[model samples]
Target: MNAPARIADFVINSNADDLAQQITLLAGQINAATHRLLKLIAEFDTCKGWSGGGTVRTCAHWLNWQCGIALGAAREKVRVAHRLEELPLIDAAFEKGEISYSKVRAMTRVATAENEDYLLMIARHGTASHMEKLVGKFDRVQRQRTDRQHDKEQENARKLVYYQNDDGMWVIHAKLPPEAGEQVIKALEAVVAPIQEERQRELQESCSTDAHGDVSAETFSATVEHEKRESGNHFQELLEHTRADALVKITEHFLATSAGGTSLQALKGAERCQIMLHVDIDTLQRNGSTHAPNPHCREFEHQQWLSPDTARRLSCDASLVTLCRYHHRLLHQGSFSIEAVRDEGHDSPALRFISAAGATIETSFFPQFPGVSAETSPLALQRLAPDVDATTSCPYWTGEHMDYGMAVDGLLRRTQ
Candidate 1:
């Protein structure tokens, strides 16, 4: 650790002269941000209820809820308010009315911390006319290397991966349209039901004929040959000849012990029509890896306060937000969200949230797993959100020079 840094942490925590302004700014900024963000959180959860909590409607409903004006006016209000959440000193400055409504919106929406900070500083210290000048400077600074990365990510996400296979089949490997699910279920039922019924009838007739007056083996063989020689046969018919247990075993063998040459892209887009469901904060962070394990996934969701289990729980049937195999880690240590659903106080913690198109999903914070719940009182679970941190002084550097000191780097390490 550097000498100045070790001392700076001390000063920052204690309000030494150089850090006095920064400490004041940090605390006030955090407070101001808390109110605005809390409103956003409430709005998000509220829209979750009122908007049927789908992807599109939650955002639209939230915009409507925030504005309380006409739809167009409310949109503008939401746009402005969300933009203001980006400003460096926005909450505190807005609280004090140092900047006008229009200026706050313009300044906050510029899309970079550095530019926002610089422009906010200039406007605070410069004339009203200086807003344009500050914005211009901010733009120029943003085109530099650092600011370009976020723009690149957004652009990359837009460029989806889509292609067609050799069989003249369409492949949309990304998130599937949730709209087609019912048709799919109906189609599957149509295809499978007759075969299943046929299997039951054949099994019954074979046993019945053998039970009293036996049918000749020649007749049974003739029926089998006729089925095998039928003009059109789908895999489902062949599957009926094999019992469900045998089908499962054979399919597993076909997949796992298949020729190594297979790329297995058939599994890629099949889960797309399934929905992504989730529980609220208390359950999300404590659960597994189905949600945001990386930055991009995190941002597309809430980005903040997301846990892998929470994300995975939400994306249970989702092909788009595919959770890795080891996603069960979200509940390894016993998370609070899993408990809250079972709390005696909760009348019915289980809920079904539907999308705008009427795609319904059943979600329960309290899953029916055998050993887990509020009743079980599992290990080391923090039920309420962790307390707002009181400031603490680290003494890692006091003993001697060290690499990176005791300050943790990386989000995973910090969380773990």
Candidate 2:
């Protein structure tokens, strides 16, 4: 029989079980062929042929337009294709049809020389869904380790930069992590709040008076035009100027208190600028409990309430102190003192707070992370990565309709 006649006969005679086995076998063969396609893609990418001398944006975009693949999927394919070059065991398994493209895709996301073998083992033993979930969990663990390391370096990275511009104006730039940045914002807002209220009150009084209603339309229009000329923007320009003025006031107040006042008076000014938060002693001793009867924090000055989670975040800094009401009042009254004590085996001096009556107020607040102690080093994250497996050394893909770049506008191109 001819080849077509024999293939048709075989298909006509096959039972359900036989067809299932054949389908599975063909699927494996397809996966194996996909590995070869990805190998070519990786070679092309490494040669920077994807650039096509600015005609093509990226390898992924070329794949999308020429191969009819979705852009997001094409990007993933490109990423996987490049990554598989570094993972040999996965690559080999994919080439041999021992694993499907789905499995290879999941393994490639996190596989490295250290964990490739373990990942391959999972791919061989598990379904695509199982492998995908495992990969997601592994990535989360890796991210958490990175975040811990970042947290350790954050303090050193904090900086404030200032310079005079060519326009004879000063420019200021600051980089602060969320908690520290929030403190600066709160201070500026506290100083600006009274000014905002005063402006609103004046506007209200003006509107209530007969004189405000007597203003001609031409006069109102001239006032708006004058404001636009001065501020150089629309309505919000005035608010921006107000904030700029507030920032200057804060800087001046800080400098004045720093250079001219007694240390106690300076401390008072500093404390006045802070956002007053009230937290229960027991709740703070706990890990910011959500089940507490009052899981809310009250803003002492603004009469606003904050969730326990927010309170926990605000209190996470090393400089945060747990002051009793009596001590807080004494602090404002200049009836308390702070002295730096150099303890044994400590690099930095510990601050000790004392009342005028000579009693010690040894309250302190420190950030708490679950399962992590205050003494835990950033290196602790190294222990969280998955253990390396010894079974595999490699990485895979599925693609079709491959094409090389055609001569376009008299230029010989290679990536399409």
Instruction: Score each candidate by Cα lDDT.
Output: 0.45, 0.63
For all predicted structures, in order, the TM-scores are 0.25, 0.36
lDDT of 1 at 259: 42
Please tell me which predicted candidate would have the highest TM-score against the true structure: 2
Query: Which regions in candidate 1 have their CA more than 4 angstroms from the true location?
Result: 1-50, 53-56, 65-88, 110-118, 125-129, 144-416
Per-residue lDDT of candidate 1, residues 172-224 (tens digit):
44432333545544545555566667875684476446556456667766765
Q: Give the per-residue lDDT of model 2 (tens digit) for 150-253.
A: 56567767999998677869898999977899999898888888887787555445544375555555655566567567767654766777778899898768
Q: Give lDDT for model 2.
A: 0.63
| Most accurate candidate by lDDT | 2
In angstroms, the error of model 2 at 388 is: 29
RMSD of each: 26.4, 25.7
